[model samples]
Target: MGVFSTTSRYSLAFLVMMNLCLKAMASESDIDFSFKNFGKVEPHLALYGDAEVNNHSSSIQISGSTNFSAGRLIFRKPINLVGANPRTMVSFSTYFAFSISGENGDGLAFVVLPVEFPLNIFDGGSMGLLRDRKIKFLAVELDTYMDKTYNDVNNNHVGLDIETPVSVKVGNLSSVNLVLNNGEKLQCWIDYEASGKRIEVRVSKFGETKPVDPLLFYYPLDLSQMWGDEKNGVFVGFVSSNGNSSQKISIHSWSFKSRMPPPRWMHSEPLDPDNVVEIKGEEGIRSIPKRSDCTSRVVLALVFGAGCGVIVAFFIVFVWIVVGSKRPVAPEELAGKGNEFEYKKFGEERAIKDGDGNGEK
Candidate 1:
């Protein structure tokens, strides 16, 4: 009974250790998600203002026919900045296909804001990004109508704005003869290199690669400073608006990729697994380091110990079964069996001697 109790305890411990190992392994793996087609509204995206998923056209319509309508679509998860320093920037790349129709007044923009749920700014010429001037954000605006009040270059142009309506850098979309409100699909690529502190923006007709010379190239665009969050993370999304004239802005497809650094709590040595892992928006598989956290190391030790314990328990049970099967018989039964064996041996010897005597005679 005591042996059985010990074995049972070891078995229970082994199961518990294995469970912990599995949980730790699951936690160490990074999360990667993608949505090829927005047949329905994605759970990871939050639609505020006038944004709605249009299944009929397989797109996200930001604004419809209503005047003074403003829309914002935000990614629910906040992207982690690379490091603690103000200059540490996170690298990102995104490709999107969009179209705008009707009387395009205010236009649309791709925004990176510090707050997950940001307040709606002014409508019309502000393009839904005019606030109390305290909001820290950046944007790439595709202006389809000229706003003289905002110092817009022309009706067709792309501008990079830093926390205000007036852009620090502007590029004429007419240089490539690209039309925004013509109901034609347009493709745009935005790439940010944190190491070089460079941003490249490309726009072209649908189904075409980025031009050799990007439409807009800016340097020293540090996103970490623009984010200005306690954790230094930022929310990315799109915003659009319509003034007195109404328009329809739709996003047919979008893909976002970024590299997320390790969390703050995991900054200690030995147990700290502070490795950069890239999260591809379309691809699923990526390699993760072995010692990503203290939990992983603990789980690994537990798994090894449990495996040894299981082997020892199995050996002990095998020895016990063998010893139990070879138990000695009763003494009286042994003596009786020995006597019958001696009597048979003597009779065989006597018969052999008689045969030898006969042969001699």
Candidate 2:
């Protein structure tokens, strides 16, 4: 809706934006632009209509026009959100945050695609307009119906299908934080409870007088909006459509960081000039490192491990002492019978008798 704040500072480490809500970001710096650092690129289609959300709430009215025609919203032209170079993309993705009530079709997708028209729509009839299309876009869908082919979290669930696969309404959402990636090949990160306000961290940057398209292109985009490297690009706006079926979806408020998570590397360390480790990939493809945001994680893990070891050792020592005490004491030599050692084995005898059940009287 409005520009994010400028006061906050974001390191190259990670893009830490404010939590999304109905409210706009305080300034431009707080809202992350995925490709801003690499180059100047603007989203061919970006909307903050009814809402703009993330892993949590994702539902909306898919239009400034014709969005309410049916129970579903559709897209005639695909919206592009580019991150890095398309050709070299090991994986590409885009996110659409919206919500759905009455399930006639599926919900939405975070797609990285190849074409423009003939966009995808729903198969199971929950997310209609934004459902199925036979194009080159990768459909990371949060499906809500049980299509015959493909996997499902339950009757209704979240799934990742390449360019409109068979009907796959995997799961439904009350408040879900779903994610799609290429590691397990495809996976959805859904959460039980919406994350409470952890910390009010922030970051931002200023805009330039120069055109912003080149920078926007650095981030990934959906196939529908992938037109090539052109100067003074065409119409740029969030696109949606509603077929015979109409559903409502919206983006609550989008707050992105310049240092957002990498495409396939969420848990890896940022590129550190001080210390860097480059791992080889399959073939000639280079692989990156794991995310090193373990500032608090490492400390917590060590503390817990040590605590458990201490508790275990204390228990073992306590048990050993108790068992040793209960063991019978050996009798010392009794010197009383004219320099002769008389056997005084009462404790030993009692222990043996008890062991043999001879002292049962």
Candidate 3:
């Protein structure tokens, strides 16, 4: 029964260790995908209203050349905004190539909205969103038509919107000698860093190198608060609408990638005791080591393995000394040949003597 209990305990420990390993692996849920040309049809895509695949151009027509047309092209799966730990927010970078070929229109936007966002709330000037007070979303708008209701900067500009159509920050493309509705393909990049709580946007003509400086940079925007405890996560998509029949918004290609970084301590190294400095009473100060001093996971693993090996070796030596000290000693009379007993006292050496007297050797 005791042996069975010991085996069961070992099995339980193994199972628990395996469960922890699986959870660690599962926490690394990253999303990475790229769409080149979008093919002749939408793959793993969801379209609503006037959104469709343009087989001739091998692109996604976000809004058709029709008056008051609104549409959305969303990836089917939701991207996690909050990490598995719920405290860390996921950081992401997305790039898309699009073109607007028309005389006049409202514009389109790349949006992140709740998973249960209503699909029917799309309008031309609203950029496929409604003016409801309850809806919450984040968007990067490429406006080609100025609307007074939303206080648009101009007909050719980029804006970052939080919750409402009204932008908190706007960037005029004319300053950079770029036109939004010039019927030319353009590329846009949006990056968010969870560590800095910052988001940046960049735009350039298609096939051009990415800009060194971002067109717009917003900080202190905690995206984790945007979802309001919506466990299902957020949906990422392109929203577009046209106010005139001649307006057309087409997306040539798109790609998205996201990462959920581990806790800061996981990337840190054990501090050296000798390097620790005693803090004085607000007088002298010294700079600590940089974060680059932290070792990688490989080095940490090797160190941990070495520590465990030392502990196991010490335990083996300890057991050997304990058992050896407790061994029974043979009687002096029974210490002859074939006595089947041989023991040495600790801290003493045994000397054998010859059979004759005074022949000690």
lDDT rank, highest first?
3, 1, 2
lDDT of candidate 2 vs native?
0.33
> Predicted candidate 1: what Cα RMSD to the true structure?
12.3
Task: Return the clash pairs for model 1, or none.
Answer: none
Each model's C-alpha lDDT? Answer: 0.75, 0.33, 0.80
lDDT of 1 by residue, 27-126 (tens): 3322334556577989898887788999998889887658887888787887765544555556678778899885766788998878644445443436
> Which 10 consecutive positions of candidate 3 have the poorest summed lDDT?
345-354
Candidate 2 lDDT tens digits, 87-113: 221122222223443433344444334
Task: Name model 1 segments beyond 4 Å from true.
Answer: 1-34, 84-87, 116-125, 260-361
Q: Which candidate number maximizes TM-score? A: 3
Q: RMSD, each candidate, Å?
A: 12.3, 23.4, 11.3
Off by over 4 Å in 3: 1-28, 120-125, 265-361
Q: What pairs collide in candidate 3?
A: none
Looking at model 3, residue 329 earns an lDDT score of 72
Number of the candidate with higher lDDT, 1 or 2? 1
lDDT of 3 by residue, 1-361 (tens): 5445555565577669869997676456578889988777756789888888888889989886477888899998888887666677888999999999755687889999898888755543478787555778999999998888889878998999999888999988998889999899999999988756788999999999999999998876788788647689889989988876568999999999988755454443244455555555567875454444434545777887898799789656755554555545777865674533334432133333324435743
